[model samples]
Structures are given as C-alpha cells and as structure tokens.
Target: MPELLPQIAEPTDASLAASGRRVVEIEARALEHLATRIDGGGSNRTFSAACQLILASRGRVVATGMGKSGHIARKIAATLASTGTPAFYVHPGEAGHGDLGMITDADVVLALSYSGESDEILTLLPVLKRQGNAVIAMTGRPQSTLARESDVHLDVSVPAEACPLDLAPTSSTTATLAMGDALAVALLEARGFTADDFARSHPAGSLGRRLLLHITDVMHAGDDVPRVGLGATLSEALVEMSRKRLGMTAVVDDEDKLIGLFTDGDLRRTLDDAALDVRTAMIADVMTRGPKTIAADQLAVEAARLMETHKISGLVVVDEAGRAVGALNIHDLLRARVV
Candidate 1:
C-alpha cells in the first residue's frame, strides 16, 4: 500500500497574498537582471549574433528541449512562427527516436536546458553537429556542456527560483521565456514585419477583420445600394432607404453621380418643417450635401473612424469618379466584427 501524505492546514488570506507578492517580486527581479545582461557585454553580443544567424537561415528554426523547458520551447516556437520567423518545436527525446529526420541542414537549432546538463539534449548535440546545423543553447550555466558545444549561448540565468523550496523551475523559466520573446521581436523588426503581416497570420481573429476587411468587402453594392435621383421627392428617397434597409439613400445626378445623401436624420429635420410635404419636398433640398463619404478601396476601419468622428451611423461608398457604388452603416461594421 502507498503511504498517505499528511494534510496541511490552509493559510490565511493575508499570508496567501504575501506569498503571491513574493513570487512575483522574485520573477520581476529575474527579468530586470536579464534586461541588464542584454544591454551590454558577452550576452548582448551573443543575442545579436543569434538573431543574425536566424535571419540568414533559409529554413525554419527547430526548437527543442526536455521536460519543463520543453513546454517553454513550444511556446517560444509558436511566438516565433506567428511573428514572421519560421519555427517549430520538436521533443529532444522524440528526435532521438527518428523525429530527427524532420530537421534539415538549412535549419537552425535552438536547444534549452536550464541546468545545461539534460542528457537527452546533450545526446543529440553530436548528431546535429555532424549534420552541419548551427545550434544556439539557452542555459542558466555558461560552463555547462550544452552551452560550451553550441555556436551561440543565450544566458537565461536568474538569481534564484521563486519556489519557497528553491527547487522548481520558476524564475529561470520566466527569464527563458522572456529571452525567447526578445529574439522573436528582434527578428520581427529586422524583417520589417508590420501589423498587416501579423493580421494575415491571424485571419480568424478580430485583428484580421479590422485590418484585412476593405470598404467594398462590407458595403452593399449594385441594386442593394439605397439610391435616388436628385429630382426625386422625400417620399421616393424614403422608399429607397426602406427597400435597401441601410437607413440612408444616396441622391444622384442624371448621370448617376453622387450629389448628396438623405438619411434618417434628414427625415427628422424635414418633418419639423410643417410647410413642406413629404410628397413634394425634393430630396436635393432636404438632403445633406457634401456629407462624409468613403472610397470603396479604403479600409473598413476607416469607415468606423469616420462614423465616430462625425457622430453618424452610415456612409455612402463612392467610386473614383464620384458615383455612388455602394453603401454601409455602423451595423455592417458591427456584423463584420470590424468595430
């Protein structure tokens, strides 16, 4: 039978909060020390060299580690991949069992072992070397075998772990992860990666919708657009607005060029003038002239900004020739998740 462990008493709320604060402080100190190291000296030079090597490589970065470090490596790989640096994680132990075939000579290897003595990682060093792949090691100990054998060493050392017992991989892992983020951001800047590039990689999210969606993609075009001739009465404009359900109708000239816009707000103002009848009031007289308009090629986010700036809910989408080609409102932006 297995031995039963003793039950420990729960601590007070004050003690729990204090413990949490201490852990955070320790981790924060580790990051501060890491920042200082990267600001100058051998570590700074090595970091620059590592980034250059990755940038020069034609293939992806192969990140590998053992145990807890392996989890951090996986996250680092994901960050690198999403930020324009091609990278993926492979288990060191699994690599020995034929996963090594996944690596190519053109690729760069990034190995993580905090203590620098993970046998699983060290065992693969010789084969990687023989394959002519450049290796970058991230370790707490510079003198460790893995650090000594690699082409570049990233020092992720911390003063100590955040664990009360000083045995868990707390502060070291935090520092290592931060270092990984530094590498990714550096490469991102070197490659001139922009928000548009990031959005392309994340097409399923809200950022993608805001960046990739254009005014034409969200606007109602052709017969669906609410439009009325400049000679039309207020009643005809209202009928067009009701038929298209866009809350506004564009007033166009004889040549089908945009002249003005008649919106719900215009109707409210027209109703206040009891002398003018809806049946006879010309749309050109009651409509708002020189209203805010967006081009079909503009980003949908621009439409949102225009609406917010003018305190309006809809816009007329026009072509380069000043013709009404489409229509959209705040509701279309809401449905497209651009707002």
Candidate 2:
C-alpha cells in the first residue's frame, strides 16, 4: 500500500492572496534580470546571434524540450510561427523515438532546459550536431554541457524560484519563456514582420479578422446598396431602406452620384415635424448632406472606428467619385465579427 500524506489546514484567504502576490513579484524580478541581460548586458551579443541565425535559416524553427520546459517550448514555437517566424515544437523524448525525422538540415533547433541537463533533450544534441543544424540553447547554467556544445547559449538563470519550497520550477520557467519571447520578437523586427504577416498566419483569429477583412468583403455592394435619386420622395427612400435592410439610404443626383443620406434617425426627426409629410417631402430636403462615409476598399475595422467616432450606426461606402457604391451598418460589422 502507498503511504498516505499528512493532512494540513487550508490556507486563509489573506495567506492565499499573499502567496499569489509573492509569485508575481518574484517572476517580475526574474523578467527584469532577463531584460538587463538582453539590454547591453553580457548576453546581448549572444541574443543577437540567436536572432541572426533564425533570420538567416532557410527552414522552420524546431523547438524542443522535456517536461515543463516542453510546455513552454510549445508556446514559444506557436508565438514564433504566428509572428512570421515559421516554427513548430517537437517533444525531445518523441524526437528520439522517431520524430527526429521532422527536423531537416535547413532547420534551426531551439532547445530549452532550465537545469541544462534534461537527458531527453541532451540525447538528441549529438544527432542534431551531426546533421549540421545550428543549435540555440536556453539554460540556467551557461557552463552546462548543453550550453557549452551549442552554437549560441542564452542564459536564463533566475536568482531564485517563486515556489515557497524553491524546489518546483517557477521563476526559472518564467525567465526561460521571457527569453524565448525576446528571441521571437527580435527575429520578428529583424525580418520586418508586420501585422499583415501575422494575420496571414492566424487567419481564424480576431486580430486576423481585423487586419485582413476589407470593407468590400462585408459591405453591401451593387444592387444591394440602398440608394434613391435626389428627386425621390422620403417614402421612396424608406422603400429602398426597407428593401436593403441597412437602416439607411443614399440620396443621389441624376448622374447617380451621392448627394446626401437619409436614415432611420432622420425619419424619427422628420416624424416629429407635423408640417412635413413622408409622402410629399423630397429625400434631398430631409436627408443629411455630406454625412460620414468610408471608402469601399478600406479595412472593415476602419468602418467600425468611423461609426464609433461619429456616434452613428451606419455608413455609406463611397467611391473616389463620391458615388455610393456600397453600404454597411453596425449589424453588418457584428455579423462579420469586426465589431
């Protein structure tokens, strides 16, 4: 039978909060120390070399580690891939079993081990070195075997762990993750990676939607755009609005170019006036002249900003000639997830 552990009293609320705060403070200090190392400290040159190696690589970045470092490695790989540095994680244990084939001669290997002696990772080093793959090692021990053998070593040694017992991995892992982020961001800047490049790699995410989705992709174009001639009555404009269901209609001239806009808000104001008849009032008389508009080719997020800044719910998409070529509303942006 397995030996049972002794029971202990649960921590008080204040004690629990104190524990959380201490963890954050320790991790924050670790990150500060890491920043110093990259900011003109001894590790600055080696950090630059790591970024240069990744930027110059012709293939993807294969991130590998064991246990807790493996989790951090996976995250680092994802961050690099999404930020325009093509990268993927391979468990070092699995790599030895058959996954080493995933790596290639053109690839860069990023290995993480806080103690700098994870056997699973160290075992693959000989094979990786033989293949001529440049290795970047992140470890707490600069003089450790893995660090000494690597082409470039990033020292992630934290002063202490955040764990109360100081046995669990805490500050060390945080420092390692921060170093991985620093490498990724440095490579990103060196490669001139832009938001557009990021969006391409994360097309299903909200940032991708914001950066990649254009107004024309969401706006109602062609016959779907609600518009009426200047000579048309308010009733005719309402018909167009109801037919298009955009809550607004553009008022154009004989040349079919936008002269004004009439919306549900205008209808409410017009209704408040007993002197005006919906049947007889010309759209030009009741419509808002030169209302806020957006170009059809602009990003859909820009339309959201324009609507927010103007405190309006809808906008007429215009061409260079000031013609109403499209229409969109807050609802459309919501449907497109641009809101």
Candidate 3:
C-alpha cells in the first residue's frame, strides 16, 4: 500500500460559510451604490447622456477594453446586439494593428478600463477622435486620462473587491457587468424591442419557438384535421379520431362551424355511465359543447397554456367565424418544443 498522507487541519465550517457570505454582501452593496449613481435625479448625467448618444448614432456601437474589462465589454456588446442596438467588441490592443480603420465617423465607441488609464485604450483615443467616433468611457476613476478624454464618463466605482488581496477583479467586475445590463435594458425599451424582434435574433431557442411559431405552423390543417359531422354517430367519430390519431375529433354543423368536441375521455365516461350506445348514439348527444379553441394565427405556446390550464390534451383550431380550420393536440406542442 502507498503511504498515507497526514491530515491537515482545515478552516472551520463557520469560517468558510462566513467568508462566502461576506463576499456576496460586499458585491451586493456595490451594485446598490452603482444604481444610486446613475439615478436620473442624481448629479451624474453620464448614463442618460450615454443612452442619448447611442440612440442618435447611425452606426454600430464598438466596444473596446483590455484584460478583465475586455471580458465585460464583450458581454456588454453581445447584450446590446441581442436587445436591438447593433454592437460589436474590438480589443484595444488590436486597434492599432489595422483595426483602427474599422472605426468610422458614424460609429460610437464604448471603452472600458477599471483604472481609467489603459495605455492601449488611451493611445487610440486621438485617432478615434480624428475619425469623429464618439467615446463613452466606463471606468472606476473619473479624473484619469481615459475618462477625461472621453465624451461621456460613466463611473462604475466599487467600494472594495471581493478578493481578499484587493487585486483580482471581483466586485468591480460585477458592478461593471450590472451597469452594462442596465444600459442595454434602457436602450431596449427606448427602441421598443418586442418579443418578436427578440425571437428573430434567437431563432434556435425555446423562447423563439414560443414567440414565432404559430398554431398554423404546427396544427393539423385542411382535411388532416380530425373533424366529424354534427349528425355523425359516436362510432363514426371514433373512426375519424382513429384515422387522425389525435385522440379527439371536432363535430361541426353543415356550415363547417365548430359545434362541439368529443375526446377519449368522453368515450370512457360514456361507457362507464351507459349514457349512450356507441353503435347508434349521435355525436351531438355526447360531445362537450363550446370547448376551448385556438385561433390558427395564435402562438403555439398559447395553445400549450390553454391545454395546461384546462388539464386538456387537445383543442380545435377555429377561424374568426368559429369554423373548424385545424386541430392541435398536446403532442404537437411537444413536437414544436412549445410545451
């Protein structure tokens, strides 16, 4: 057997838990401080001005930063892009190496530097200025070169870092990230970014399917819809249900207007209660009247909600005139990932 290592004393459980809690408390306090600084009634007009500048810009929002700030900058750019504002991230170090040409007069630059003195960011300022690129600086230091040179300076000052050593990015990065989210949300509302617009951006996500996929896209339409005449027998309705494999069938009047619905539950209830004879019973005598229906143009998620709320498995898709145009079941919602 290999030699056993001697056990060393670890910190007490209380000490570890307290340490984690202290870090979270400190970060939470930092976010609270940042929120007050950007309040409209506050002395700082930095955030509102920044939003106005970006809103008026005809070109993209170019984000640039170094090190930890660069990571936050990239996330901020992504949030901006997804929320409606067109934005992209470019590294400050890469700006001098032919990337400076990408900056145009119509573009606005958002540069992040916690210390407000990143040499790479500062050096490219004059060139960006010459190109008429409006600069917005997110920094902890308001008097530093980067902040002073920028057209707008939004302070993301944090009282302390979560790091015990005070060197690692912790609370400061969290504050910066929260500030970025605030800016993106503000712009999102200002631009009227709707769920449909968000769906188009995230076409592969579940939220996209819920917002963009309509009942018409997944409901069984045309002759494939499980439908039966109002005068049809219960046995004939069962045949239609079987042929459609929907476990339910819609009963319509002579005008093809939906009159009632019959499902497997009704069949079980009928057999148990001896309410009707399957061989000769009319469908109108046993079907549920005024059943919940979905419009073909409604979102598939709405159908899923109706089914879930009513504890149902299927619904008839009806037109504005109450005609049976399609049929949708819970399985269809599942297949479309709307469930």
Q: Which candidate has the top score in TM-score?
A: 3
lDDT of 3 by residue, 98-209 (tens): 8987877899999999999999999999999988899999999999999999999999999999999999999999999999999999999999999889988988878788
Lowest lDDT sum, 10 consecutive residues, model 3, at 37-46
Off by over 4 Å in 2: 1-9, 205-212, 271-281
Tell me the alpha-carbon RMSD of every candidate: 3.4, 3.1, 3.7
- Candidates ranked by lDDT, best first? 1, 3, 2
**lDDT by residue for model 1 (1-339), tens:** 999999997899999999999999999999999997774765358889899899999999999999899999999999999999999999999999999999999999999999999999999999999999999999999999999999999999999999989998999999999999999999999999998798789888788898889999999999999999988988888889899998999999987888999899888988999998888778888999998899999889999999999999999988889999999999999999999
Candidate 2 per-residue lDDT, tens place, 1-339, comes to 999999997999999999899999999999988887774665359888888899889999999998899999999999998888899999998899999999999999999998889899889999999999999999999999899989999889999999989999999999999898888888888889987787787788787899899999999989998999988988889988999898999998877788999999999999999998778888888999989999987889999999999999999988999888999999999999998
In angstroms, give how far residue 187 of model 3 lies from its true place: 0.9
Task: List candidate 3 segments past 4 Å from native.
Answer: 1-16, 40-43, 205-207, 274-278
Per-candidate TM equals 0.86, 0.88, 0.91
- Give the alpha-carbon lDDT of every model: 0.93, 0.91, 0.93
Arrange candidates by TM-score, descending: 3, 2, 1
